[model samples]
Target: MAVCLQLTTSNSSMCLCQTFTTHLFLPILYSAMFLTGLAGNVLSLWIFMAKISGKSPTHIYLINLGISNLLLCITMPFIAVYYALGTSWSSRSLMCRLAINVLTPVLHTNIGVGMIILAWLALSRCATLVQHSHGPRPSKCIKILPKVFFSRLRQTPFALGVCMGTWAIVATASIPSVVVYSMKETEVVEDGDKQTCYSVAVEVGGSGSQAFAVIGIVIFFLCLLVVLCAYMAVIRHFYRSRKSTVISDRQRVYARVFRNIVVIQIVLVVCLLPYHIYKAIFINLAQTDSGGNGTECHSLSTYVEIKNVLLCLAALRCSTDPIMYFLLDKTFKKHTLNLIRGRSNTQDSHSSRTECGQSAPYNNSSPKGAATHDTHSHSKD
Candidate 1:
C-alpha cells in the first residue's frame, strides 16, 4: 500500500482518517499471509527445483510463478509494519515513504505476474490435452481459435520465454504507474508531516493514478475471460473422453487434468475476482463522487477497508498454491511425502546421477531413458 494525498480543493481539507481495519486488521491479515505464503512458496520451489524429475513447460511455469509469489511474500512484513504503526508514522517519514514507493510496485507486479502465469498454465494445459485427445478437435469447441497459438506453449523453452516476458511486461506497466502515483504529482502530500498513512490520498488516491488502474483492470478481466474460455474448451474436449464404455489410461490422465484446471479456476475466482470487481466499483465511485469534502470521505470510507480486505484475499493464493500443487501433481506430492518421511526418491536420485555426468549402472542418460522421463512428466501433466 502506498501513501496517498488528494489534489482536490486543498490538501489540508482532507481528513487523514484511521479505523479499526487499517490499524488493527491490516497488520494481522498481512502477518498471516506472510507466514503462510513464505512457507508454502519456499516448499513448492524446493520441490520444483530439486525433487520433480520432469522439467516440463507447466512445471517451469509453476517455478516462475512460485518465484513471483515469494517476491510478494517477502514484501508482506514491510506492509504489515507500515499499517500496524502508521498512526505514529507521518506521511513524510522517510522509511514509510520509501516502503510505499518500493512495495506498491511490488504488489502490482506480482499480481500481474500471477494472473498472466495462471492464464499461461490454463492455455498450456488446454493445448496439451487437446493435442493428445482422440475426441473432436478445438474447431468443434471454439471455431475461431487457432491450434497453432496453443502448440507453442507446450514447450519448456517457450514457457521460459513467456515467464520472462510476463515479468518484463508487468514491471514495465506497474513500476511506471507506481511512479505516477507516488513520485510525480505528489504536491498534495508535500505540505506537511502531519498527515498519517490513513489520509484520503491513501484511500481514493490522486486522480492521475486511476488512469493506469483502469488499464490494469481491463487486462485483469481479459485474462479472466481467457482462463474461463480455455477451461471450458478443455472440459468440452475431455468430456467426450470420459464417456467411453471403459475408461482408458489416457482418460485417467485427463481426469488429473480436470483436477488441475478446477483448482486453478477456483483460485482465480475465489481470490482475485472479488478484489478486482470491488476495485472497479471503487474507482468508478471515486471518479464520480469527487465533489464532497475530501475529509468526510463521502465516496471511499467503507470502500478502502473492503478493498484492502479483498486484496488480502487475492494475496492468499500464494499460500494456497502449494497445497493445490500437492493435490494435483503426483510428482510433487510424492516428493513432498518422501522428503517429509526422510526417504530418498530413488528415481530422482537416478536422474540426478545421470545429469551430473556420473556413470550409473543403468544409463538413464540414454535417449530412451530421457524420453521415458519426458513422457512420464507429460503424462503427469
Candidate 2:
C-alpha cells in the first residue's frame, strides 16, 4: 500500500517538535504537483477528445492514462491541505481515509497501469515492424509466443479490456490498504491541551501493508523488465533492418512510436524507479524494526523523509505525461497549437485535411491492420 509520512511517534512525547517535512515541504510539493498535474491532464484530455477519437490503441491508453492522472492530481490539493494543517485531519477520519487510503493507492495503480500500457505499446510496435519486414503471417509453431499473443493489444477493444482489467486489479489490490487505514491519537506534550491527530495504522508492521508493498515492488520491477526488453528489441530491429532497400510508411510510424517509447522509458527511470527502490528498502527496514529491538526513531524519521521526497518524485510522473503527449504525438501537438491560436473549427478541419494529404504512405489508423503495412489509411491520432 502507498503510505503517507508517519508524522507522529507512538512512544515519544517528551521532546516533541514540529517536523519540517509534514508541516512545510510536503504541503509545498503537493500543491505544486496538484496545479501542474491538473492543468496538463485537463489539456491532454481535451486534446484527445477534440482531435483523437479513441480510434487507435495508443489513443485509448493515453486517454485512460490522462484520466488516472487527473483523478490523482485532484487528490493532491487535499493532501496539501492535510499537511498544511500540521499533519492533522481535524477529526475528519473519512477525509484521511480518502486521501491516504484511496487516492494514494490510486496513484500507485496509475503508475502500474501506465507502465504496462507504455511497455505494451513499445512491444506492439516492435512486433509489427518485424512482421512487416518478414512476412504477413506468423508460423503456427511460434504463434503461441507471448509477443504474438499480445500483438492484438493495439486493437481498440482489446486495449480497452486490458485497461479495465488493470483497474480491477488495482482496486482489488488496494482493498487491504483501505481496510487497514484509520486514525489514531498521538500523546500531548507536558501542558498539552488536546491530543494530536495522526493515523497509526500500518506505519511499519502490518501483514497487509507488507504484502501490498512487496506486491507493488514486484509489479514495478516486472513492468520495468518488460519495458526494457521491448526497448532493446526495437533498437535491435532498427539496427539490423537499417540496410533494407525499402522502408514502408508503417516503419516510419513505428520509428516515431519507438522514439516515444524511449522517452517514456527515460521518464519512468527518472521519476519512478528510485521511488520503488526506496519503497522496498523502507518496507524492509520497517519489517526489521517491527520486533522493537533497539529501533532508531531518528533513522526511521530520516527514511520517512526520504520516502516522502521519493513519493513527490513519483508524483511528477503525472505532470510529465502531458508533456510527453505534446512532445511525442504529432496529432496532439497540432491540436494543442490550434487551440492556443484560437483557430476556428473550420480552420482546424482544413488543417486536418492538409495533414491527411502529405502524411506517410501507410494508414496508421486501425492498429490491427497496421501490422500488414497497409498504405491506404491515415496516420493514427
Q: Highest TM-score, which number?
A: 1
TM-score of candidate 2 relative to the true fold: 0.79
Candidate 1 — which residues are off by over 4 angstroms?
A: 1-16, 136-147, 185-193, 291-299, 344-381
TM-score of 1: 0.85
Candidate 2 lDDT by residue in tens digits, 67-129: 888877887887677656534453344565465556666666677777666666655554545
> Which regions in candidate 2 have their CA more than 4 angstroms from the true location?
1-22, 89-95, 133-151, 183-205, 246-258, 290-298, 353-381
Pairs that collide, model 1: 4-201, 5-201
Clashing residue pairs in all predictions, respectively, total 2, 2
TM-score of each: 0.85, 0.79
In model 1, the Cα lDDT at residue 312 comes to 83
lDDT of 1: 0.71
Expressed as tens digits, the lDDT of each residue in 32-72 for candidate 1 is 88998998899989878886554778778889999999999
* Candidate 2 lDDT trough over 10 residues, lowest sum: 372-381
